[model samples]
Target: SLGLEKMPFFTDSTMAKVMLLLINTWLGAPYFMVLISGALTNIDGAMYEAAEIDGASRWQQFKEITLPILLLQTSPVLILTFAFNFNNFSAVYLLTGGGPINSEYRYAGSTDILITWVYKLTKEQSQYNIASVISIILFIFIASISSWNFIKSKSFKEDSE
Candidate 1:
């Protein structure tokens, strides 16, 4: 049923995926907003004045001055966001119980992420070793992507000194 407005929407898998995506995005965006606001607040007012003297429009100032500085300062926060979202399982588990009804899959629900599926395997099916293996794989994948993004953001190369 998945309890969408006190009605069952889980009968259709497409609706379920859409709902889950919305919920996950809702949970994630606030952290990004708070972080970006803080970074924006810390920028020196002189930079904006200089850009204005050079006849830069608002968009040009943001593109040339603001975003580059914010990206440089907030790289680690972005990395943390990706890492946290990589293993997020509770949102899917709580919403759907990982299923629509009686359907057969090997320890996976339609919405089951790697972390949630591993939890179900070890806790419900007692496949401890295999769950551990899957967890390690998930960790490696997230770590590699996060590291790459972190390094790429370091190329912002603003003169903070």
Candidate 2:
């Protein structure tokens, strides 16, 4: 006995994206918090005191000191997190199953990411060649992003200097 009640947040594609993002953030926030907490431990309280003595506002101190130090300390973790999320096959597969299918698309559903699309190509359709190509492209994309992030990290720069 189905009712005509509206639940757009669950049914709508746009809302589904928001829901997935919220879920992802909820899942990832703990790890991010831990990394940031460790970085915060490394920052000297004297630095904040000195900044306050110089008449720096809270926002200014955060922007000039805390943000940079956190970013520097957590850059590697950030990069790894990016890579992990980029290819998060299990989350996509188990939670949504690349669902809310769009009839227009050949194999991919509305929520189907690259990994899921590749899975469909390989498993359902048995198109190994195309799946391999897609996998290669995905690998290249992830690798390039990771490489750029690594190069831009403070540790890399510090080592070079």
Model 2 root mean square deviation, Cα atoms: 2.7
What's the C-alpha lDDT at position 5 in model 1? 71
Model 2 off-target regions past 4 Å? 1-11, 157-161
Give candidate 2's TM-score.
Answer: 0.87
Best by lDDT: 2
Error of 2 at 91 (Å): 1.2
What C-alpha lDDT do the candidate models reach, one value each? 0.81, 0.85
Q: C-alpha displacement of 25 in model 1, angstroms?
A: 2.5
Residue pairs with backbone overlap in model 1: none
Specify the poorest-scoring 10-residue window by lDDT in model 2.
Answer: 7-16
Count clashing residue pairs per candidate. 0, 0
How do the residues 34-91 of candidate 1 rate in per-residue lDDT, one tens digit apiece? 9889989999999899989999999999999898888888888878877887677888
lDDT of 2 by residue, 46-130 (tens): 9999999999999999999999988888888889988988788887777677777778777987777898999999999998999
